[model samples]
Target: METTPCRMFPFIRSKTAQSKNTELTVNGSSSSSALYKSNFNLGTILCAAAQDSPQKTAIVYDDKIFLSYKDLDVAARKFASLLMTGNYAKGAVPCRPEDRVAILLPNIPQFCIAYYGALYAGCIVVPMNFLFTEREITGLVKDSEAKVLVALKAYGTEPTKAAKKLGIPILWADDESSCGMQALLSSANPLPALIPTSPDDTAVILYTSGTTGVPKGAMLSHMNLFLNATIVPNTIRPVEPDEETIVLAVLPLFHIFGQTCMQNTTFARMGKLVMLPRFEPGEVLRTIEKYNVSLFAGVPTMYIAMLRCPESDKYSLGSLKMAISGGAAIPVEILKEFEQRYGIAIMEGYGLSETSPTCCSNSVRQGRKPGSIGHPVWGVEMTILDEKDQPVPDGQPGEVCIRGHCVMKGYFKRPKETAEAMRNGWFHTGDVGIRDPDGSYRIVDRTKDMIIRGGLNVYPREVEEVLYMHPAVAEAAVVGIPSERLGEEIAAYICKKEGHEVSSEEITEHCKRYLAAYKYPRKIEFVKELPKGPSGKILKREIREWHKKMKSKL
Candidate 1:
């Protein structure tokens, strides 16, 4: 039998002979087994890839800037030297376990330099979204107790003000003649060597979007990130070091997907990443044609926009092999249309900031099944539990819980929250899902999002799926709005097709036939567009809050 690579090594045929770092091979064929290994540091993985492919193009932007492994090393060294000249100490930066260093920048080389530089200096990196409001920005900075903030020229004001309010210094990377990279690389100083970080050391303090309330910092360790990046790519496909993989990095690096998949994963595999400040469908298609991009990752909204692009067919996207979708659920209809049109499959995955953002993903080799979030990644365990916290039968909807290496250390400084979320050694994902007989999982809806109407529980996804079947409906989101009679009533927010028109009565009538009497949406609102997060995820919490304010006015 021919041998193939395994993402996670399987155990020996004899069960009792397992080793910590054993590589499993079955019947003289590696493809038949998975590999089991001990955890490694994420920094080591990045440096190793940089060393292995010293001359390959690492990043490409508007002007086609390419950073060879050697170049990145030297540039990082120079930036490191500049950082060392500051309050940052030579060894480990002497930070308390939860100390945060805020990073506020756009999708430029400085973001990476500042990010890795902070980590190399042994300070916990808090990557703030550059689009945050002043109050929101200050709240996170004060909450995290960030000592230093790095901001790009375009979005430096908010960070500067926040830093000033908090009595912290801001490092601005604004240059007319040269960019942040030019300034950092031109500095005459010796870069410090990489810090010796343990796998359990807190590498980043990723602040959640705070969709629910004030955002809380998710403390991810080197091990948490290392496990995710190492396992995700290997399971999806075996990437060769010499393969010239061009990745379209439109997703923000501050988000977990872009950080792990595009930044760290690309670095580990020695692939080239083409950066974009934001997603413009035509521009993305043009860039794809221009650079011959091979790999792509984005949220569902991007795929929808790209498909709706009038000039989508004008570009030759034959180079695209795979596209990964996360941040929100990908509609099966959209997935089919994209695959049919572009000859590329968008593999949908599921995760949260609490789990390094990639707990499950559809496998490229194993044919994607519509609506499934695929199997669990290597060294991770997943289970579906009922409201009572007891394991539910297969094919039954329940809350998804995750455990193992990819699980975050915990919420930063929120011991009560950490304890509540990680009960019984499993991080309780608020999202509800069901496991099929084949071990694939499908998310039903969020546990908190289930609507209770006159004592009957209705999963919002069930109602949304029905609404999506409507011919005129372009997008739909279901939420529970407070009602005087029913306690909570199902409210459907709809965005219709450009030329089509639909009324609230028609939507309610359409739902009545396809859904249970109580499951049908009682109230409806038609909007030109749905409110979305930076990643294009429908902000359900934001919608719910808006509904609450409207009801209050009534």
Candidate 2:
């Protein structure tokens, strides 16, 4: 193998040039620069890193399987060969460029192999949540029009059923069966080279959480994901020359937060990734200490669980350099307490599946803001806009708008919705936020999640922030419930800490002291736990369903 210069920090400098059939732009006008290569493929990051450091460990799974970069690259090539030659299963056809390949797996090594393999073959990769049922899997697969499905053997039943119904072949990983991915890899020859792909070619199709309606697949191009994976780390805190960056991959790989920020970013820097199939507070701490992890990223709820873990202090997490929080608005109270307890700064960022998931982040060099999402990274422009699509002044709340190299091309097969979101050359985020005079942004709440009671607007995040301050509260979700008098009344669902109990009246009184009459939750319900998505974000949609059931009973 020829040695390739490790372009660890491609965006460090700026140059504009033209490649084969496309224009390449590398500019330093923004705080973060853009690196757009016309003849580029996302899978090359792994191949280049492997050539640069073949013997270095790339992935450590469950602290048992340690895969070197060379081994991982070879495995990805074998899988690509399987896709390109139509040798995986009966009735399978050779995949063409832009073909959709669905992946239904967890945060294991096979997920990485299959993901990069599909990209190497110049196919669009579609990742699905492993927890989805057969119905959910079938719906997503059918919607994506995927030519093939790759899933773990343990979770293959539902995906296989979906594949059969859709007339697509399913490849099982980690199975001793004759049809498993390993068996096919043993019989297939490694692809000699990665298929050429243009920077604008769609590389991934990430589905949104669909809080408003049906989930839409966001189309991210090679340039979008590549720029985000490289720019975010340099903008926030670049890895030092002598330092070894080890990332703990507890966040679900299917989610954008983990896929781009954690997995792709680690590969871009030639760092080691420690994979955990699921998030358990105790197991997370143990893994971090055992592997001497330097970087960690997770949602707000993960931090809350780790803070509340009784055995968290037993592990000396001195190696942790920083932690990132996203996926939701983290309460200021919890952020402060966790930082004080663990002595690690939690840098909050903001992005969506459409923005390659890392547009705005609190920078280490700029100093940390307690509640702000910080400024836009290099190559990204963010502003607050009013309902008229006009930019709003500083300190005023409006819809957050972003335009950047990291933004997705558009939603797949939904031109109308795409046009609605990408109006005025900026993507309307649907999130209400305020911008500081210094350019920092703070999330107010989602426009759909805001509650209006008696002609006054109430943001659930503000009330939930106060609720998190309660000593006995472990987790809290605030929502707007139906009311005959007011348009919508505030409701709080509280999950108390273990061995601690608090009444609804006590919780209401605590909120009353801090919030106004309409801002405090009028009805408080104590629950054992709150519904969370794959990334451990509190799901208000589920809570709303519970409220509907309770109202029907009443």
Candidate 3:
């Protein structure tokens, strides 16, 4: 039995916010209108677009599968309809809008349908990385208390293990089985009523890098996501009205960078998002040449990888007009070389999962500055503040704090940590940065010893925790070493237990079994003793400096 459409969806069409431009300010001065409608539900970004252009192509899957806006809406409705059955649906258990539903998927049409579908049902979406190991996935599900897990068919056995362990219902997409996505979508049941959510209600719970402690989930509200998503497309890098916006969504959709920047922005713009599950330099070139992709939202290493591809010049990627660089800093030399080769301007930005993943970015207009993340986007206020929360003088390095509409609601289930992070009315990003004379911000370094390898954040503590579990390992300190190809390469320095000898190859392979492929340390250095401060804390900075000196000599 399905709820009546009229009762379920109070507004069949997306409603515009009453105070349209009421949510923004420029550097704490002039007020700017909200970029997109924040008053409405996030799912309505697709609904409004579907109603406007039902037959327009919205999703392209590896250039094989295509879904129009109407099809996507119906698909979302179908997926939502399954969740509405209150245990009557073949695969899904009763899922209320308040319950968390963790999504584990790669870049595919199902990722879009499942994400929006969860939002459509009024459920909080907890997006998980598809490359996570069984234990990692299990921990996230347990932490988030996800009642129902939606995953693609190719996820292998990890999802099943986690679901069974958690005693939760698992819905599989791309499968024709009874518990598969198609079975639910094919149901004749009507769509459920929309569970109206407040703008401040948490829309997504994005997990932060657990460098200092266990990864904390950042609670991003509907307004937070909506405001941040709009700034990039509307102000930072607006697609020309006549241009058919084709975004290369190669970044993992589970991360906030890809979700808000590529996936949501494309749908909001009523443009096409080409889904590539995993990034391959060769295939990326092929997809661009085949589809004439206009927007390439990628990290610094991706650009380096593409340039290093053996078939680099074999394919014509001339269609790319605008590019976005984030995740990690790109060497100015590499940035210049890439633009010259690709003939596209790569605008740099800085953000984290907490700030809807975008606090400061370079706009397409006049404020563009290479090697510097441009001024705070409309409605967002960014500052370099000292420990006392006082604004530091310009050109001086300090903690980057962002206060704006895009700031996350708080950290989920961890109020103390949230208080620490969101103290004094500013979300403190533990990144050392300087505010240049032109108000543009440049990242000097990270206060937190986090590593960005190939644009994926590799928290040293997480890797250290894993290494500590090995029987042969007594103590381990993980650090990042510079690399031209990858922004940084992970290196683990270990002091083995007496009488226990383990080969580096064995340790690396062991890590591969437990961690993601990119997370495993590429180099393992056996040391008798690691440098430590008087307080007994490992001196990671000293180790980094040591590596730099050694590399220079080599």
The model with the greatest lDDT is: 2
Q: Write the per-residue lDDT of candidate 2 for residues 109-216, one digit (tens) a residue.
A: 889989998998788999999778888889888888999988877877788777778888888876766677767776555655677889999999999998999999
Question: Over the full model, what C-alpha lDDT does candidate 1 score relative to the true structure?
Answer: 0.74
lDDT at position 349, candidate 3: 85
**Candidate 2 local Cα displacement, residue 28, angstroms:** 45
Q: Report the lDDT tens digits of candidate 1 across residue range 460-489.
A: 878888888887888888998887787888
**Count of clashes in candidate 3:** 5
Ranking of all predicted structures according to lDDT, beginning with the best and ending with the worst = 2, 3, 1
Please identify which of the two predictions, 2 or 3, would achieve the higher lDDT against the true structure. 2
TM-score of each: 0.87, 0.92, 0.75
Error of 3 at 456 (Å): 28
Question: Between prediction 1 and prediction 2, which has the larger TM-score?
Answer: 2
Question: What order do candidates take by TM-score, descending?
Answer: 2, 1, 3
Candidate 2 lowest-lDDT run of ten: 9-18
Candidate 2 global TM-score: 0.92
Judged by TM-score relative to the true structure, which candidate is superior, 1 or 3? 1
